[model samples]
Target: MAEDPESGGEKTEDASSRKLGKARDEGQVAKSVEIPSVFVLMAGVAAMYAFAFYFYQNLMGVFQFNYNFQGVPDFTRLEAIRLLYVHTEKILMTCLPVFGAVYLTALLANFAQVGFVVSWKALEPKPSRLDPINGFKQKFTSRAVVEFLKTLIKVGVVCLVCYYAIKGELTEISRLYDNSTGAILLFILKVSFWIFIKVCLIMIVLAFLDYAYQKWKFLEDQKMTKKEVKDETKQTEGDPMVKSRIRQLQHEAARKRMMADVPEADVVVTNPTRLAVALKYDREEMDAPRVLAKGAGPIAANIRKIARENDVPLVEDKELARNLYSHVDIGKEVPVEYYQAVAELLAYVYGLKNK
Candidate 1:
């Protein structure tokens, strides 16, 4: 059913499991980009800290090698290409592990947020996504406004953190000209690392807030209207009237099967009108007589009619019939207390058969 905004208005109902599942299948789930960005930044910085000595030595060697190079390798094209390749290779070898760690951290962060999700629908090209009108609406949406404000706050916070981090090291920065080249490099590295840590910490807090907001937006978008819930329920579970009719037909079919077994019964014990208990005994199969069938009201009348037509003997015992119907189930042995009463009825029915 089409959702008429003027009629029902906004969706106030909570999202159903089916709705959530459909949304997930379409790759619409709450996930924040900040989580992976934060993790990758953290991993890159941590890796740099852990491998600082190795990186510093290799970097120094590359700088020395570059400084000692003589006359651009005789100005040949092949030599020029070779020089470029060697420089690129050295840089890659030095930075490869750090880049790899950052990539791995991003993958793990995404996995933590939404595990092992693969949806082709998310990657499929949709015209709606390219629609300028829809894009404009989304850009001006309340959620977008909040996200933009959050981004501004994060940038401001990181800038403030960086300022404070460097504020303490102004004197060290001023004395950089007097220090040796290696000492100056080390000082710059330490100051940059301190600023990186401060910015990373501020972003971590912002990432958590962004993640929370993403989840809230996801739920709001997935909410269902009352008619939507009802229609979904009907689709998953058949219409009420149809279900009731099916149950009625099932009852009739079962009643017919029970009536067919009444002919095999040795006797029909009845409360005359309200209850009827039909029991059958097999010496080899049963330890005690079982209730082949029992019924009440109209069903009791049908059982009596079927028994009389089949020429089975009828015994009117109100107490015995009531006890059997109440305490015993169809296809189950009667209660122990009713065994004596049932035995006497069976003996009388057998005597009649013998005559």
Candidate 2:
């Protein structure tokens, strides 16, 4: 099919909710991986600081346990293996909480961004992913260029931050040789942890910028053309022509029913050529006269014709017909003001029958 240039070209319209929903279902959400990375890094650094004393105590205890194994100890294979396991357990005890906290932070960050969404569709393999031509286009696209620049900015910022942080700590490094092993270890931890905290804090600003840009871009990508919007609306709500046809059918059925009841009305009032209203009255069955049908133009003409064919009276009092057509409904009593006029008309009709 020949495509309309507008639909195939730039997308200026806002994305429809259906498009957004479909994208979400496909696991195409606007979220930065960097946001979670920053949070996880912060969590790890905070965990390190919180657990520092516990780590120091465990390491000291391990050192003491090794030292207290006085003098004549045999270095058997089983003893070496046992020592390895014990030390490994100690290392895990020192490190596990930080790792766990970082994992939880990553999960929490992801949850805050897109909530709970599991999509195997996103994981499905695509052959186009392996195509070199498509890959080249993807690699050189504007989005890819922005991603590269952002990465470059992050690296440059971190390096500058590291240089300044380390420059002030140069004298501290010189004192490490004279300091106790414990003091040196503590100094190293403090320096690394401080730099880590600074990097995470700085990265947070970049992450926010990236997240906002990604969201804007995602919505822009989802935008549709006028033609596409119309097509989608028709698909969901139904085509206008089909609806109009159904309405025509319904109107025809109603007209037939009204015509069937016209023969039973006591009188049909006409507004000369424009309007007609049929009124039926039965003393035994009703308290007052009720309108059976009313119509304007062609349908009014039909009502008048039906009344003539059935020998039903066609009274054409312009003011009275206009009032009845305008004020009274198809199956209701005339208003109080018109009661005198209607009573006189009915009396005249009865008098004529008596004559």
Candidate 3:
């Protein structure tokens, strides 16, 4: 059979092939990293501490050399050494918050996109996972291109903001040369505050952009082809072959039970071509006529053979046989509407037995 290309190149009627293909296509890694708000908060704290250390070292230099030192005491050496504490503290303080925020944001973004599902099924190693071609395809996809562009934009924006901010502060440096201590201290505080604000605004913008990209990537990855949807439905529900087999087994079991009751029949009625109905009647032992054995197709022919072997009468009643086969089952009483027809058939059979 020529395979339908729309059905994913498989000739089989199984819908799952298309579904599995869709799942594979959508499963490509388009993951996004969400930096948590806690990281930004920690970054802000680290920035404040950095500015404080800068102010402290410069103040220390002024105190050490004011009005009495023979030379500008080595402020450079002291500033450099003190910067070790500043850098170290900044890193230590920010590490937990920044990484924690990143982890939290990643979790939330993933949950929002895919729901809160913890399945080890997806983690199971497969032969496809080892394929270099698959890896290369993932690395060079449109999702990867978008991620690269996002990073570039964030870096460019932050650098531009920082450059403009520092450039505007250069003119204030000369005023600090002849100022009262209070004025110089105030100027340093103002410049530090502006820098902090600029960085915070840039960080906020970057975070928003990251979130938007995360949503877009998630939607793109979840889009499904029609064939994929049908295949998944079959896998999750059940295979048609298995269900059909189950029904066949049930029908065979029922047929055996009905045929076993054939020995008790008084007469077998047949449409000859399609139906056979074995009926039993007892005036004193039973209230109504009952079907002992009944069948159609091959089983119908078998019922007539059994009646012949047992010496039970075989009556040809096309209307009664067809009606009984259609409306009743083996071991069930004949319906009220069939009473007149069945009574006449039974009387004729009994009269023949008596003769």
Please, what are the lDDT tens digits per residue for candidate 2 over residues 177-290?
998667877887888888998898899999999999988888877778777888889998899999999999998998898889999987887878999888877889888888
Counting clashing residue pairs in each candidate, in order, gives: 0, 1, 3
Where does candidate 2 stray beyond 4 Å? 1-7, 61-84, 282-288, 327-355
Q: Which scores greater on lDDT, model 1 or model 2? A: 1
Q: What are the models' TM-scores?
A: 0.92, 0.85, 0.53
lDDT of each: 0.87, 0.86, 0.71
lDDT of 1: 0.87
**Which tens-of-lDDT digit does each residue in 60-88 have in candidate 1?**
77777878776655768997898799989
Best by lDDT: 1
TM-score-superior candidate, 2 or 3 = 2
Query: By summed lDDT, which 10 consecutive residues of candidate 3 come out lowest?
Result: 29-38
lDDT of 3 by residue, 1-355 (tens): 3445765653433334454345445453334453454244445545555556555455555554455569665668788788677666655553544455546655665665445455455777889989999988988877788778877876787688768877888788866788876677767667766766766667666766776776665544444555655666668777778888989999989888877778778889998768999999988977889988888899998888877888889999999999999898767899899999999999999999993
TM-score of 1: 0.92
From the highest lDDT down, the ranking of the candidates is: 1, 2, 3
